[model samples]
Target: MPELFHKVLKAFSSMKAGVLLLALLALFSALGSTLLPDSFNHLILFNILIIILFFNLSICTFNRCRRIKRLWGAGTGIIGGLRQWSLIILHIGVILILIGGMINNWFGESATLRLAEGEQALIAQDKSGVGVNIQLEGFEIELYENSMPSQYLSHVSLYKNSKLEQQSTISVNHPLRYEGIKIYQQSYGNLVEVETEGQGQVDSSTVLEGQILEIADSKWQVKVFKYVPDFDLAYGMESKSLQPNNPRVIYSLYQDKVMAGIGAAPLGEKIEIASGYYVEFKGIKPYTVLKVKEDPGLPYAGAGGILFMLGVVLAELKIFSKPGQGNGNRKAVVE
Candidate 1:
């Protein structure tokens, strides 16, 4: 075992080892992305493993090489007192980031809940129901001068067991955090027209100018994501039309088997397909999606970063020049 360790150390101390390890890590990262259901776990584990390997290789190489020691001293203030301290600091930083990511990935909790105005919902699955409940007061979408969406906001209040905890606003990129729950303003939808026509009882009946439907039933729920009018069609590519006066919705319907969706140009044009019933453009109402998440490992990651930086300073501040005198920047060779 010791002999094997020596051989491994010798290989890792070489440039070839660094190159090979980097290549392997890159390949594993790419492969990890394509893995199903087990992505975060595998990716985090691989990341930490590679960091350890790199640290070992760096330490071994630094200990064996004199030039490495001088470079480490030149790089940081604290580790600068010792030979190869910069290498150690650099290794520590890599380890910190890896560990941070691992903790964040493993312990992070995320969920999503839909609530209408005056509706309150708890954030997670708990038997005790001891989680925060968020009440959706109102939702709005603001457009830029060019009519493009500039911002989306959700007006909400958080409560814990009937007690008003806080009133907060959430927006894209800005999340609201309370009681270990983070709510992200993910997306929004507008009011749309629903035209429902049934067979037999309401055969050949078209109910245009219908209001939006926001109820979940045994089948699929309907929601209006976006509408575009004056849609244009280019060659080969799917066309887009978003003239408000003649709006077309990019809508989706999620079901158990079929995930049916349509980018209905001019809003409601019937595409003939065999389904349960005929399709219609239902009414539109505002829809807001909130992403809730909690992660316990954030502090550790932060601490690691600070330690890594300190290590860097320590490694660079310490310098030794061959036990000889130096003329300004030039070291005098001791005979």
Candidate 2:
């Protein structure tokens, strides 16, 4: 029984066992990447590899710790002790990183929110349930010359239990964090607000272009034909110069299967077509797209990364330094 236990320990602590486990892990990882297997299959493979590596690392670390203890008892000096300790620390850091990755893969959450200025919405966790409230205070789009979008900005406020907790601006490469959730600016779009009035009744609608809306008791079908950020008329043809200085929309109005009018309506302007019936463009608002993420294991991963780097530096220094001069001719051997 004693010999069998010894053999089992030796097998698990051997470098050959570590190498075999690593090779198998690499093979499965490569296959997963190339075949693009289902997410479940990939997860199973990853878990199996992690389990094998975890046991192998535990046994190896235990054996190394015992060996180092014996060396220290035999009066090995400070440098040799430092070298062995650094290697152990490095292995522990790698294990922490793997654990952190597993935790993040299984438990992290992400969602997207589309909000217009002054709009409030509940932030959901994986679309499951509302976790918090977020209000879009403002949205801005920076444009370059020739009217191309350069950057998107969203100023938002976070609320918890109906009380405001934080307010911040998020943009490309700039993120806001609240209670372990990170919010990033993703995209922006234009929205048009339209209102129609007839016969002492008022109807309001908000839509994007290419959408058809019925207002004032379904008698009038309004279709937004085109939207121009900058409207211009040249040579009797409508032209949009692509600058957002003068936003307008070309809309078509129909009443009882007959085209009433087709014309351009500028922002904040009202056009009367048939007596008391009129359409107004209430201007455009920028809607912002935000990506929210929550990963609890990120801090663990960061700490592991820092420790791994420090261990590497310490190990390298010990390796390159003069061997016998440091600590009484005792050399540390790292596997």
Candidate 3:
């Protein structure tokens, strides 16, 4: 029984075993990404590979450490001891990185936040039902002389439990980090403001592109199907450019859910709906889209990264670059 146990240990600690496990991991990862169904146990298989790789790394590190400690005790010199210990640190760093990545894969989550200017939304809720919210204070877009968008930004204020927190600006590639969550400025678009006034009733509302605007207690509703920034009649309702040079909206008006009229008009153009009811397109308003990601294992992976860099620095500096130093990949490691 003892011999069998030793053989099993030896197999796991072998370099061949490690390489085989890594190959299998890569193979299944590719298969899972391209072909495997999510309902399959590919996740379970991936976790099992992770566990075995962890064990393999642990055993190899233990064996290497034990051999290095023996040499240090027998006076193999300070340089030899330092080199071996550096390798040991590298091995430990790899183990920590693997564990942290697994934890992150299992626990992390992502969601999106969409807010028009002066709009508020709930970003996410924790296990205890405590929610985090953000309000879009303002949005801006910058364009080059050629009429192409150069940059866009969103000024936002965070809130927790109805209490205000600090405000921040988010732009492309610049994310706002608050309360262990990251909010990235993902995209921006225009919202159509619709206003109707008739029979002494004025109702106002906003609608995103390709959405409908309906009036309460009224038979008139309109679906703004498209928005063209640089409207050109010569292009058959297509925009000449993305500069909002001649902003126009194409819409289909409906009465009692039946199509009444279809037309295209510039922003703020009033379209007659009925004898005493009319709807006008207000100015375009910018809305911000944000991507929110929460990953709990970031700290763990960060610590592991520091340790790994420290190990590499130690190996590179070679505090005592004698003939017997540099790495610990000698026959002793195999033995």
Candidate lDDT (C-alpha), each: 0.58, 0.75, 0.80
Candidate 1 lands at a TM-score of 0.60
Which candidate ranks first by TM-score, i.e. highest? 3
Per-residue C-alpha lDDT of model 2 across residues 73-131, encoded as one tens digit per residue: 98876667777777778777767776776677678767788898889888743354546
State which candidate, 1 or 2, has the greater TM-score. 2
Candidate 1 vs candidate 2, lDDT winner: 2
Tens digit of per-residue lDDT, candidate 1, span 1-335 = 99999888776666566667767767776677676433544465675666656565556545634564454455532222342444456555655665666676767777777655677887753468576678999987777776667888899998877778889889999999775567899775444555433231222221212223332233543444445443444411222322245445555554453555644534446532234344455444555778887766666677768867876675444255334322322321110
lDDT of 2 at 266: 85
Position 280, candidate 1: lDDT: 56
TM-score winner, 2 or 3: 3
Worst-scoring 10-residue span by lDDT in model 2: 234-243
lDDT value, residue 326 of candidate 3 = 42
Q: Candidate 2, which segments miss by more than 4 Å at Cα?
A: 1-44, 47-52, 124-131, 144-150, 191-242, 245-284, 323-331
Model 2 lDDT on a 0 to 1 scale: 0.75
